[model samples]
Target: MSHAPHSPLPVGHYAYDEVDRTFLKQRVAQFRDQVERRISGALTEEEFKPLRLMNGLYLQLHAYMLRVAIPYGILNSGQMRALAQIAQRYDRDYGHFTTRQNIQFNWIRLEDTPDILALLAHADMHAIQTSGNCIRNVTADQFAGAAADEVLDPRVHAEILRQWSTLHPEFTFLPRKFKIAISGSPQDRVAARFHDIGLMARNGENGRPVFEVYVGGGLGRTPIVGVKLRDDLPEEDLIAYLEAILRVYNEFGRRDNIYKARIKILVQALGVDEFRDRVNAEFVAMDRARYRLDEGIVAAIRARFGVPDFDPAGQAAEKLAQQRKADRAFDFWVRTNTHAHKQPGYVSVTISCKPAGGIPGDVTSSQMNLLADLADQLSFGELRITHLQNVVLGHVRQDKLYGLWQTLEQNGLGTANVGFITDIVACPGLDYCALANARSIPIAQKLSERFASPDLQREIGPMRLNISGCINACGHHHAGHIGILGVDKRGEEAFQITLGGAADQDTVSIGQIIGAAMSEDETVDAIARIIDTYLARRTAGEQFIETCRRLGTAPFKDAAYATA
Candidate 1:
């Protein structure tokens, strides 16, 4: 069952054909002209802002940032190398991966952006809809086609949604930005419940994917779990149903206030039941037949994704166990980093971008190329970007796992604290983002150093500690089990703690404010104390979230303010 190294066919299902390549070239040419116009003083900054934004270019505090879309977080090694090339040539020698499973080049220049887009075109990638008020890049489970618990592959429908929403004349200018997440796995890996439209898709009796839709779910100043708008919706009707929701939100949604423009606000104002009624009304009246997903189209899209060849009886479970007994570090890595795959011999590996003291999702240009090469050698030339600011080799075999680990360690990519306390998700914060009120990276660095012990991290078990620089919740603090939100207090940076939020299928909830804002030092101390308190109180090996759910925030709050 031995496979050739870097085979001609990649395990990644989606391959861009002539049509997709043509579309990218055309888009790049258009952006190239726009960049020239802006450079030559023909287009004012104000005039060029929207055009640039439509292509995922942003004016950050220091410089222009370009966000390249990794649609559904799916891209191959070739695409990864393309990103590395962009980083090496156009901007800084590094790129920061975002919470949305996209990469951001923080030091981008306006003049070089057109060239960058043109280069991206060669790799069959683009930055379209990565910004603007449109339905932004659609995200699904990182282990979409491979998770052992998957009900059905959600990416087919994710790609379907991408096609349906991209430049759709109606949704191009909505009340505000909209986000949608889909999960085929019952375990919910992609944080489906926290999106604008969250869909939980399962296999139907007819083998077609059926979706349970959740609308108005978002986090920010107002963090709320989206409510289920519809149940058991056939795949064919998905686009139609979503269009209905968009139509309702676009028409009656608030146009006056920037803060109140999200679909969550609209859902709140109208109430969930009323909002559902409106969507249902639109669904019944619209041209449902025209919007229905055609079987031919679905088949074509699915065909683009080539299924990887897997060894049916090639698992080296005994060999892995023996190797685990030999090397403690490798064993520890295997314990936390690898996840179950649907294939017999393969396991999905999460490459921790969160080195103990390094930035959470920042990957160097060289590291990107190394990962690209590694993806080719071991993971069928495919890589997945996790929403938690990490990368995944979705189809790694159990036998070659040790070699992969060694190479990753040599290259400074082998931190094994995935899902542990040290794997904190944080935004760029005041360091790079103008919208940030406080420094998030420093706080994350402090926490990572404080809980650097592998034994301590294992003892704490799976923890979700998220930090946001402001009320915007870009770091998804509201969805973290132990959330720290930076707030302004008398011209000084302070943090507020929230407890008991969960972002999975088991329990979807927004974390509650446990206590008042505290200084940076106090915030880290509070998190440590909270973890220590959980160890004392948790009867079994219950995770931080489970403990938070069972024991309530009362105890954690006490520990947080125990000294204060």
Candidate 2:
């Protein structure tokens, strides 16, 4: 698998077929009425909470956290602008893009939620299943359809799943939440191995799409990489495969202990091979093609994701060079922030929401609006939210990089460090999530501060430091080259370290714990020791992983413990 990453198809199992404009308008009215009842006390908070959550509203620490689904990680410029408007009018100054390819507004009020939903509906967007123990937002590689290495657009399958899972009756109340991710590319940019279900698209001998299914992988208290259960499953078996996985989970996943409730535990307890056997038996028992995916349906969904037109006749290449010659800043930005697109005249640009020492995925309302405007003006009316918690302008012409950078810089998004060390993926640890055992934001901030130098990050060459608030692995710490997981030591916070973990195509390795957990203050110091050990032992051009493996963790472990 080398192209890009895939998403969790189960999340997309409930995509309603597009109806006429009249029905679209009618559904909005119905939801609006429900909102009115909830807000006006006609519906109690207890009665409304589930409904609101189903609509992607969460009453969080300071305010309501609204999770808007970017179905299969696809968004048009019109939709992006709609979200920007919601950020500006109803909430605070900005939004947070999430690892699920969703955008969240942290400052929404309860009263304004319906209006927000209404706006999203207008753009054919909603916040359904963003929370609760049901399937979450279906996510795929941000570069899904357009990546050169992709075999087929995984989003098409994601859309299929969304239709199947939406308000599904059988597995809705399973022991705990379920997450799924799929990928079509060999390069695992979407972090499939860390997801509950990871689907890789491969071609069969007949040149048809076949799926490789991975089950039981997760991030929380138990971080286990998913185990592949079935290989070369025919395209028609997608739904049956999903049913089998969920049935096994729903039947045996623990419910008594919340901490032990995830499917990962069930999969682990049964052992990977045994679990696969059980799922296969269940699949065999199901009515063959009972959940058959209709070709017409698949085609209809694909039609919704049509590619934006690119004007090959335009002055693209020459203009790009002129812009580069005119501005060194623009030149550097092009080299770092922009990615080559399959389309000749267009490029994909990453907008870093993680400024130095700032929260990794925070986007202001103003910035969101500007991005929307820019999307319409320069590219197609579309923007994509990435699993890395960054926003991407997918169809930007290389010629417009200068103007885009100029506008983005003013909005605090022009950080010319896409794959640098400072571009960390961290969860909203103890400060926000109830599941978090330790604080993650501060640790991320410290790491950012430690590796803020552009030169240092470049020298390091794509080191990923993922920090989780807890073992639940929301931060994807288990897959980072340098992974940090927070653990609860009695009532205090401690950090556990793992080295050589990687979330890439060639290899999927969970880092080994180099040493025992350390206190918060000592954790950063521990990371420093690890980096120093790597630097000292590196062969020319050797990556952190290569170095770690060559020397093993012994030397780094010794240094960290010696200081302790």
Candidate 3:
């Protein structure tokens, strides 16, 4: 089938065109046929596994898991409602938001997948490229375009990458799964340094967009920080440059051992200089014209990203200040859950999915409906899924903040914890994932319950605690300031701790292992002891990470293993 003409873009959002729609329909049909063959004994389990995986379906320990991609973490009310419908009808009554800006339904059946995919297609979304050794979802800063400090919207280029990498013939089956992340702001909210490829957009000396490209970063098994390959690549060279990097990787990346298959291993094998030199040679030899993006095409894509019309006369600061004065809870919510917006009188509100003693990234069907309604009425019908496993209404008027907070509070969505320690990023460990060695959610719950007090959390200040069930690093434990990795020691659950890791502010560092693994009970106490060490050692203004960096792991180690 030929490509379809572009349709009109949705107001303040991007909508899939006829071509996109046709593509999804065709893919769903293809998967549906494959499913029939497998069920009829025409194909064996081993033979059909890869086929099912390419369409984002996985056979976990309990049931089939379907991971639906939320490109760049952007969603509208209609799409959100569709997800709610899928959660209610197909799987459980809730969906799990992942750290990769996608949602996975754990109880999916293979028979229901084709229908579910059809439903998603109607909403202009899909589960394609979400699994199986290819470029995964292209993630960007959750606050892209809305943040006050962004140089430009990273989604613009992220979308470009998404389009270019989707089922590209050359990259259909890489040695390992590949991921790419982009950031437009100075702060690295997307954990750019932990992806296979990281791109940071900035203004060049000539006042044009340039990217600082980093390659060979990954977290699974062996975590390594990405190294910069290009300091200032022009906007037009994005595809060509990316093609060069991938070509080099496709040729040299290891395939002999599954553990050493990631591009990071190859990059390490041939130092950064050698890798860069190889990529440069490839770039020099390629037909640049074939990949160079035209200004018209760029502008067309940019136009699809409709900007929200701000109320020019809306003055919300005074009203918000008055609301804060009257209500302490509202005040706390404002301070903790809201972020500064580029547009005056507006703010980006983080709807905390991480309530104390709850599943880290789950939202019920009713909660999803309520959030969709709130987004439509108060947030220009736009919502974003954060990489930190939360939801964001990126365009709420500050004047409506009080009412919005009240509604969210009523629905148990108004937890005043965004950057706090309790705002954890956890993978569906032994509870859902078959690859998991130990449980992650229960540990997160115990930790949150231990430090449920808002006062204590505030005093503790901004902290990131990520938990991964295994070294696969789905929970991004390697990027957290305090990272927890669940391991299996002698067939028993044990948790390993790492300290001083960071993913933001261009200060990317892999965490250092503190000590030997501990049992589930000992793990929580060890965390508390670590906190106590930080509390006792911290200066007046030092954060947990700062204290750890200053004192190294000596004090925390001594405290964690000390006998009472």
lDDT of 3 by residue, 327-429 (tens): 9988988999999999898889999998889999999989999888887787777889988999999887788888888888889899999999999999999
For residue 150, give model 1's deviation from the true position in Å.
1.4
User: In lDDT terms, how accurate is model 3?
Assistant: 0.89
Better of 2 and 3 by TM-score: 3
Off by over 4 Å in 2: 1-49, 313-332, 487-494, 516-522, 561-564
> How good is model 1 by TM-score?
0.97
lDDT of 2 by residue, 300-374 (tens): 777666555566737888889888898877887798888777878778888888888888987776777777677
Against the hidden reference, what TM-scores do the models get?
Answer: 0.97, 0.88, 0.97
Q: Which has the better lDDT: candidate 1, or candidate 2?
A: 1
Give the least accurate 10-residue stretch of model 1, judged by summed lDDT.
1-10
lDDT of the candidates, in the order given? 0.88, 0.78, 0.89
Candidate 2 TM-score, true structure as reference: 0.88
Q: Count the backbone clashes (under 3 Å) in each candidate.
A: 3, 39, 0
Query: What is the lDDT, from 0 to 100, of the residue 556 in candidate 2?
Result: 84
What's the C-alpha lDDT at position 379 in model 3? 70
Q: By TM-score, how accurate is candidate 3?
A: 0.97
